[model samples]
Target: MAYTLGIDIGTYETKGILVDHAGAVVAQAARGHQMLVPRPGWAEHRPEEDWWGDFVFVCQTLLRESGVDPRAIKAVGCSAIGPCMLPVDVMGAPLMNGVLYGVDGRAEAEVRDLTDRIGEDVLIARCGNALTSQSVGPKILWLKRQRPELYAQTAHVLTSTSFLVQRLTGEVVIDHYTAANFAPLYDVQTQGWVDDLAEDILPLERLPRLMWSNEIAGEITGRAAAATGLAPGTPVTAGTIDAAAEALSVGVDRPGDMMMMYGSTIFIILRAAERVADRRIWYAPWLFEGEHGSMAGLATSGTLTRWFRDQLARDLDPAEAFRQLATEAAASPPGANGLLLLPYFSGERTPLHDVHAKGAFFGLNLTQTRGDMYRALIEGIAYGTRHVMETFADLGQRPARLRAVGGGTNNRLWLQATSDITGIDQEVCDKTTGASYGDAFLAALAIGAVRRADIAAWNPAAETVAATPDPVYEKGYALFRRLYQQTRDIAVELP
Candidate 1:
């Protein structure tokens, strides 16, 4: 029987899955790694260890555990957290640690400089995006300015998935979806690199060749075959960012369908009927051709929950800390006992796009317990998600459905709170294996083993988290907005 392989490099871990032609998950494996935060606004990942190394382990382990012949895998697909900025040499060796996504705000000056030089209106008209922390163009310019010596040696700029694809297939290519995050460097109308904007940062030649997500980038090379257990010449698709793949895994196709990914960050993607030209949110060509996508994200979400576990709940065993926190949080009444957190620990993205935004707890009282604080953190993230949803409504592009995916979906309180706060029902699918599962499905589609619509059958909506109205939460959501607005100036003054 034919099979496929899917791997995803995430912020904190890498996961891989093997699936048969019918979409049954045959086996899975994962590797954990650290995400480095060298400075307050900087985040980096060791591409060699965290990305490529993890990928090799996942590939070999998945093959061994499943007892499936590597040759039986018809195609391979991969997705990762992006669009990261990694400079690599001509041989595709990473020059330095990969600069991560919106959470890394090291390019603040570059963002302003590019926006001023190119003119924001022109950029929006040509590329359908504004210069922000998420834009790869600014990150590239930051490298040239801050580390000129290293930039001089750089041959190509790549995101996480592109780096993996090159490692696997000896091809340097990026999907249109991730390319859209490159901002002024990629032209939405032409669906190609904007030479003028890109040349200013790096020569157009340094950019990866663009392709659709489902297109075959190249066959696995002999070198990749040796490192990975897979046979040489295995077909590989031009995989996309993790959120896109996660969306696909849950059948988030067709206009108005949306995916609310609760992972390291809170990422929301809405399938738009047409390009919704809004500066508050990002617009990208969808994974497939003839489709459009609008996206928004918070810089931190599950990461905050993890932080709470590590710092505050460290007395408990690592495995028991999260459970204890969740138990305590459930006991805390809604509104988190009058506590409120901004959920901008790294920075804020979308709508605000304020890299200087600081996380804070308002209305803290001595009487409050750890559970109240934990619940406040979850509520804060839910409020942040609601803010993004309201932004979509403001643009007249509100989604028809909201599908929740990722590890955070396991947190019943968080998912239910998000729905209650956002007033949108969330559909949870049976398989929340996330992007890896989506990668396998995408690979199957590329190899003609599965039709595009078959994802619905492979993973159906298992349950719904309906909005629960609460007057207390209604007041809390209102206060959440005001707190951010009032504290904006204070955040700006924080050194």
Candidate 2:
């Protein structure tokens, strides 16, 4: 019997899964890691502490629990957070901790400088994106400007995937979907370096080779094999971001199907053949080869809820607190008695794309209870999601249904709230956050044991929940939309 392994180095955790050829997850193990914030806005992960150590632990745990022979595994695949910049030396040692996604605002000066160098309109015309903090080009430029000496010694710049691939296969490679985020550094049209863009910052000679996710990067080295309990010389695929792989696992095969990943941040990945560029919405690659793919997202989703539950309601036990809060939230009819939450604790991304936007509690009343507040918090995020969805339709791509994945979908209230706000049905996966399941499926196809057409047969049985918008609630949501739109300026102005 053949088996495949899938691993994800997530923002807050490292997870590894062992699956047979049939898409059945035979064994799974996970370990949580810390997210270091040295300053107010900077987020960093020590490569040795978070990436390597946690991955070794996950591999050992999964192998021990599964009781399967390591020799039987055919291929290994990985998914990780996207577009993070990691500088590696010739021996492939990390020079510094990776700079995280656009949400991490430490590179504001670099963003401003680059925007001035390459006009925003010309950038949009060439690469289909204005330089947001999300792109690696700005972060690379930041390192060059701030630490010129370190930048000079840098041999190659790699993302989370490329760093891991270098360790496992001794190859420096990147997947196109993630590499495209390094805009202007890479020419999306020509699929190579953009010498004309950001030339002052750094030489673009060493960008990792861009390959499709299914392409084989290289076999695991003997050293990498011993570190994890895998057989030597195992082939590893050039995989993708956790959200993109999660979408594949939930069966986002066609353009109409949207993936709503309720992870550390909210990611909406919609597949489209045409380039859809809106300054408010992030328009980038979405894991398609030789075709245009787009995604839009918010900076916070599950993390904000976690912060609220942790800092605000620490005294209550998790189940007891969530049960109490969810029940209270469910009791309040839609609109939450005129209370609304901005959910911009970490600033807003997607449709709004304003880094200065601060979270707010709008229309709060002295009569409102904690229940109303909790409901508003959840609804605020749902509203943020709705804004992105509305943008997709505005650009001529509309998702008929959202396949809910990640730990957030497990909450019935959150799932139902997603349906209620969108006025569309949601298919909550039997196993929410099933990237491994998706990886297993892809691995099986990569080995030719399964056909691409048979994915529907392997899809986990999902409970379809439909939302019928109430006239009263619809009227209230209209006000919710108006509040954000009308007072966006005020929200951005807050300290």
Candidate 3:
């Protein structure tokens, strides 16, 4: 039977799946990795260890556990956290740790400089994005200025998935969806790389060859085969960012369908009927040709929960901490007994685009229990999500259908709170394997084994988190917004 292999490199873990032609998962494997924060406002990952290493381990594990012949895997697809900036040498070796996505704010100065030099209106018109923490061009400029030696030695700049695909096929390439994140470096109108906007970022030659997400980039080389336990010459498609793949996995194909990914961050992607030229949200060419996508995300979500567990819930076992916390949180009422939180531990992304934003637990009282605090934390994230959705609404691009995916969906409190605050029903798919499952489906599409519409059949929605409005949430959300605004000056001034 024909099969496909899908693997995704996430912020905290790497997951892989083996799937048969009928969309049933034959086997699955995963490996965990860390998102290194060497310094404040910076995030990095060791490409060799965290990315390729986890990939190799997961792929081999899937093959061994499934006992499926490597040759039976007809095609391969990959997705990863992005758009990361990893400059590699001519031999395709990383010059330094990969700079992570918008969560890493090391290039704030560069972002400002570029925006001031080239007007935001021009940037929005040409690049379809504003120079925020998410833009790769500023990060690249930061590298050129801060680390000239490495920049001098750099051959090509690649994102996480580009690095992975290159390691597999020996063909350096990137997908249009991921490439769009390289604002000022990529022109949306032409759908190609351009060095004309702030030419000092890098020569256009240093960028990868762009392809659509489902296009076959190249075949696996013998060297890659040896490392991955796959047959030599196996076709691999040009993969995309993890969130995009996750969106596709849940049947988010048509315009107005949004995927609310509750992973390391709460990433939201809405397929748009046409290009959305708004700085408040991101715009990129969709996986398929002639389609458009708009995106928004919080700086922290699941990561914040992990931090709370690690710091406050130290008595609980690591494995059971989240579950225990969820139980405790559920006991608290809708308003979290008058507690509010700002989930800006890593700064804010989208809408606000404020890198200096601070996380806080406002209105804390001695009477409030740990459960109340936990509930407030989850509610804060929900409020942030509602803020994003409202922005889309103001732009006349609100989602008609919202599908929730990723690990956070397992947290009933978090899921219900998001719906309660946002007042949007969230459809949960049967398979929450997320990007890896989406990768498998995309692999099938690349090989003509499946069509885009087949995703609904592969992973049908099993349930919906219905919205239940409460007056408490209405007051809390208002306070949530006001707390951020009133404290913004003090927050940014702090060291």
Candidate 4:
């Protein structure tokens, strides 16, 4: 029987899956890793250890456990958290740690400088996006200015997925969906790399060759096969960012369909009928040709919960901590007994895009318990998500259907809170294997094994989180927005 293998490199883990032609799972394996924070406002990963190492481990494990013949796997697909920044040497060795996505705000000054030099309006018109922490162009400029010596030796700039695909197939390529984040370097109209917007960022020649997400990039080499226990000369598709793959896994193909990914961060993607060029949100060419995607996200969601467990819930067992915390949070009522939290620990993304915004727990009282604090934390993330939804609404681009995926979906309180706050129902698919599953499907599509519409058959909707309006949530959301506006000046001044 024919099969497809898919793997995804995430912020804290790597997951690989083997699926048969009928969409039945043959084997699955995973490995966990840490996201390095070398300094405040900086996030990074060791490309070799965290990305390629985990990939090799997971791939080997899946093959051994499933006992599937290497040649039976017809195609391979890969994805990763992106648009990360990593410079490699002539031999493709990493020159430095990979700079993560918007969560890393080290290039804020570069973002400001670029915006000022090339007016925001012009950037939006040409690049289809405005300079923000999510844009890789500023981060490239930051590296050029801050580490000129290293920049001189840099041979190529790549994101996480590009690094992985290059390692696997010896092909230096990037998908357009991920390339859109390289604003000023990627012109949306032309759908190609351009250095005219800002020649100072870096030479466009250093960028990867662009391709669509499902196109075949190259075949896995003998060296890559030896390292990962896969067959030599296996085809590998040009993969996309993890979020886009996750959206596809859940059948988010048509315009007005949205995917609310509850992973390390709360990333939202809405397939648009056409380009929605608003500075408040991001726009990118969809995974397929002749399509567009509008996106938004929060700086922290699951990561905030992890921080809380590590710091405050240390008394609980590490494996059971999240479950215990969720139980505690569920006990607290809608408003957390008048407590509120601003989930900006790593600054804010999306509508605000404020790198200096600080996190806070407002309206704390002596009566508040750990349960109340935890509930408020989850609620804060929900409120932030609603803020993004409101921005989409303002643009006349409300999603007709919202599908939720990722690890955080297991947290019932967080899921329900988001629906209640946003007043939007969320559909959860049967197979929540997420991006890796989507990768396998994309691999199948690349080789003409399946059609786009086949996704619904592969993973159909299993449940729905119906929206329930709550007066308390409405009141809390108002305070949440007001609190941010009133304290913005002070938050930016801190440290």
- Candidates in order, TM-scores: namely 0.99, 0.94, 0.99, 0.99
RMSD of 3: 0.6
Residue 133 of model 4, lDDT score: 92
lDDT of 2 by residue, 1-495 (tens): 889888888888888888777667788889888667787566778787788787789888988998989889898888778778888777778899988776676777777787788888877777777777677888888888887887877889988877777888888888877877887787666766676877776677667877877778888899999998889888888877777788888887776778888888888777666677766665656565655667888887887877777877777898677777788788887788888888877666677656676777888889998788888888888878877877887888887557878877767888788788877788876666466566666666666767766666667547987886767556666776787678778865665
TM-score, predicted candidate 4 vs. hidden true structure: 0.99
Candidate with better lDDT, 1 vs 2? 1
The clash tally of candidate 4 reads 0
Supply every candidate's count of residue pairs whose N, Cα or C atoms clash at under 3 angstroms: 0, 1, 0, 0
lDDT for each residue of candidate 3 in 25-63, tens digit (9 for 90 to 100): 999999999999998878889999999999999999998
Runs of candidate 1 with Cα error greater than 4 angstroms are none
Ranking of all candidate structures by their lDDT, best first: 4, 3, 1, 2
All-Cα superposition RMSD per candidate? 0.9, 2.1, 0.6, 0.7
Model 4: per-residue lDDT, tens digit, 258-371? 999999999999999999999999999999999999999999888999999999999999999999999998889999999999999989899999999999999999999999
Score candidate 2 by TM-score against the native: 0.94
